[model samples]
Target: MNKTCPNCGALLIKDAWETVETNDNGSYVFKSYLALKCLQRCGYYERADQNDQE
Candidate 1:
């Protein structure tokens, strides 16, 4: 089942999060993750499981 915002009753949306990091040696690392967000933009969000399980 999909998740809904408790305050607004709107369907939650799935989105991706990504970031890049660099070290003093000029090496860089990339990171990404999934998250669920409230469609109403209520500042509600949670990270998705690494296995993509609900």
Candidate 2:
């Protein structure tokens, strides 16, 4: 998922990684990795919108 800075409206790139996890019920779940953003200006980061997906 891509995120942006709410304060500064900076573009952020999320490096998602695939991984498997077992729950208490012995169920396998897939999870992706998340990344932080380096906000410019105000040093704030927020999630990007669907329209931002290009």
Per-residue lDDT of candidate 1, residues 1-54 (tens digit): 788977788887888767799989999999988987789898777787764444
Summarize candidate 2's per-residue lDDT along 33-52 as a digit string, tens digits: 44445446464433434554
Cα error, residue 34 of model 2, in Å, equals 5.8
lDDT accuracy of residue 37 in candidate 2: 51
- Name model 2 segments beyond 4 Å from true: 1-16, 34-54
Q: Candidate 1: which stretches are off by over 4 Å? A: 18-31, 50-54
Candidate 1 least-lDDT 10 residues: 45-54
**Candidate 2, residue 17: lDDT:** 40
lDDT of each: 0.80, 0.56
| Clashing pairs for predicted structure model 1, backbone only | none
